[model samples]
Target: MSLSVVICCYTAARRVQLIRGVQSALEQAGDRDEILVVVDHNDALLADLRDSLPHQITLITNEFQRGLSGARNTGVARSRGDVVVFVDDDAVLATGALDGARAAFEDPTVVAIGGAVRAEWAVGSGPSWFPEEFGWVIGCDYRGLPACGERIRNPIGAAMAARRQALVEIEGFSTELGRVGDLLAGCEETLMGVQLQSRFPGQRIIRHTDFRVDHHVPADRATLRYFTRRCYQEGRSKAVLTRISGRQAALSSERSYTTSVLPSGAWRARRNPRRLLALVIGFGYTTAGYVTGLLLSTRSAAAA
Candidate 1:
């Protein structure tokens, strides 16, 4: 099966992190259908990459729009492969990850695969106040995920691979949904997965936890303010997602996460006083964000 790996970058600030991503791709590279570096409306970054990237790797300027979704869509357009894998510019893949993707796509029913991501803390350890249950804040596959390869609702953008045909059929990632420049908003991945499922019922969007990557979480993200803001932004993003993809099913997992997961995590943290407080604050902030976002969304709908 032919494979195309796409990496998206938006700034020169991430140049060091981007180098690590490039090296990982090089190590995993073979006869790729193509390896594209999609620069998202950043001419300066694009120019710098022109002097930096190896000649074998294809460079793409995202003319589609100015977000991660658009950059990814541009990459998909330039790619000629049965399967397209999107990797984050800040992540490094595990050995044989690409090979595993090629093998997984051999099954025609497997439309997409989300590999696990292990957090690599910039300070070399997780912050005490940063609850592991909220790991999704950094785009890492947080806890409560399935322990093995199985049908998953969505693929985390850090390392998600999908069939070329499925992405085309669904019209690729939504420009309204994902990260644009500095925004932490997501749910574009969720929207794409929902579309894929709608079009090809019973098709598998598998989560293979063993196909892993090291995702760097900067120390700045360890702050309570950052975590809370990210959670708030996620709530807003999900509101938009629910609007675009229907409410009940789009929020099924959110209900589970709120009603079940956080409560269990709070119980587990009972022994640790700080952790207990962290869990409570985390849940409170996130729920508040979701409600506020929902209200704003309702107002927007009424106006429309």
Candidate 2:
């Protein structure tokens, strides 16, 4: 299957990372593959990239809403490949990543595929207090994901792909649920996976460990404050997803993560006071956010 990589960017602050991401995609693209750089309503960044990027790369401004989901939707619409892969602007595709995705899609039963996202910290390694189980807060592959090739409820947004038809059937990513400007809200991918499964019953969404990407984790995201805020936002996103897609479908993976994965992680971190404390604090914040979001959503429904 021909691949179309959609790298979305919204700011000039990540100009360096975005360029590297595009370059990585370009290097790994097959003869039939294409790379599209979607700038989320940023005119200045669009103009700058147009001049700096290679001619083969297609750079365009987001013609939909002003956020990550909209930018991704715009890319999906413009792309011509059989598989539309979404790569974050701050992430670099590993060698053969596109090939891996195409190979997996050879199975007609698969509709979506996601790969590992290794963290490339801005400082030495990463914060010692950061727990591995909560790596999703930084868009990295966390501890407790299935061994690979196993089915997943959803693919992480930073490095995921969907069959073009599957995406078109679902009408692309929902604009309601993703990062808008500075808001950390997300779960667009989660909703997409649910929609895909509903639309094509029996189809699979699996993770391919070989199809990997290295995501740049800036210093700002390494802080405790950012960690808490991100965890809370994740909870809020999950609540929104549950409201839209029903709780059973929305929180299936989360239930397992909470009951099985987290307990194991906590036990492993018991020897490290800092990691153990971080895990506990992160869980508390996420739970608080989920409750707050659920209450707000319920109130809004009644008010409506």
Candidate 3:
């Protein structure tokens, strides 16, 4: 029942905070636990980072740079815990999060459990009129309330844990989808979620309100350009997910005419039509990306 905390570190910018996250996890872990920080590349900070923690923090550096997905896979390979808890280098777990997660995964059917991700700077982040279904910009309850339940989709990568065996069975995260260099896009986690659901239909992918993590959204992500880019990427990823799964059912057509775009589209539209316009542009971009990805795949296959 030991827990393996896997923090995939690309650079040392987040080394300190991630160490704190590791320490927090160690404190909360009732069973035997070890922290495996997978460093994708070697840097001057490596020496200092190595000396900064207890022997429990095992640092595994790659000979060549592997991206986030690769680093995670590396960590998973080197870990010894039955449950592999993954937290982004920039995220810190809330008190008792690991304990709650342990209980959540006790059900044999449950393969994974994701913690509630609350923005550390939620005070002035955005208008409350945002949609909950949108995964690009995730923000849990602002005032620290226990908002727990079954999730319709995948949980944020900020804080989630899975049985090591299940992750191995699924082959871990996807290298094709997540942010590696400057891609600024993501869908690997969502695609994994879809696969998990397909393989284990009765098993509930529970989001434990009791298990929470604080994600510090950089100020750069608060701008309009960033939000729009995120929306575009999300739309693109949606198309990719649908194409891979062959599951398309007029995603937004179910909602009432007024609120079909997003949860807060109607509210924003009442003030300015830009909200609806944004939705249209997002969908168009998504369709284009999806078609382009499919065509490219076909071309590559033909060449092969």
Candidate 4:
């Protein structure tokens, strides 16, 4: 099947190191496959990317810089493929990954497939090991080894593929679930999955353990400050989404709530000779940030 790869990027100078990871995908993709780079108001970086890549890569400069969701929609509208793959500009796909993903889609019941993600810098970037205090918090090591028969709630947006028809029926990603500026709001992928499952029951959204991607977690994201901001954004956006999408959106909110309190559970393990204290601290901060963010979101909605 033909594949269309969509990558959304902004001003990513310091994170250029991640580009090498994306380049690795070229090795796996066929020459006829397409790469659409969506640049959200980053002209300089767009120029650099255009010059660096081959002519097969299509570059679209978002005139209004309408955030990640809007950019993805733009790319999807312009692309032509039986299957559409969304790869984070900063993530690199593993060798032979796409071939396996294509195989999984052969099952008519499988609507979407998520490739597992590994930390590119589990040692050098965050802490030498997973942070004990925040290990259970969002953005931590993904424990994706669910039983082969189990279905996942959501697919990580970084490395997901879906039938183009399903995406069209859903009308693309939601603007409410992605980040606003530097904030780290999430759950757009989960929201999309909800719609997919409801529209096509008995159709599974499987997680391909072997189809992997290396997510280059920037050093900034590893810092306490960045994580706190991410937690806050996630909390606030979730609350806002509930208002916009109704009670069903609360499912996403629950995930945000778990992100808030999970650190303490990890903390409890820390005292039992688990040395996961850092992860605990990360989760604590995440909870605090989510609470703060929810309040801010409520106030902002009232004002608007």
Candidate 3 lDDT over residue span 118-226, tens digit each: 7765346643433333334543332212247665446567887878877787877777667674456766666767667766778766667666787766666655566
lDDT of 2 at 11: 92
Better of 2 and 4 by lDDT: 2
lDDT tens digits, residues 139-213, model 1? 897777766678888888899999998899999999888988888888999999888989989788899765678
- Best of the two (1, 2) by lDDT: 2
Between the candidate structures 3 and 4, which one is better when assessed by lDDT?
4
Between candidates 1 and 4, name the one with more favorable TM-score.
1
**Clashing residue pairs, backbone N/CA/C < 3 A, model 2:** none
**Inter-residue clash pairs, candidate 1:** none
Instruction: In candidate 3, list every pair of residues with a backbone clash.
Output: none
What is the lDDT, from 0 to 100, of the residue 141 in candidate 2? Answer: 94
Model 1 worst lDDT run, 10 consecutive residues: 141-150
Structural similarity to truth (TM-score) of each candidate:
0.96, 0.98, 0.80, 0.83
Quality of model 1 by C-alpha lDDT: 0.85
Off by over 4 Å in 4: 63-65, 122-125, 128-141, 144-149, 247-249, 252-268, 271-285, 288-304
Give the higher-lDDT candidate: 1 or 3. Answer: 1
What C-alpha lDDT do the candidate models reach, one value each?
A: 0.85, 0.92, 0.66, 0.68
Global CA lDDT computed for model 2? 0.92
- Sort every candidate by lDDT, greatest first: 2, 1, 4, 3
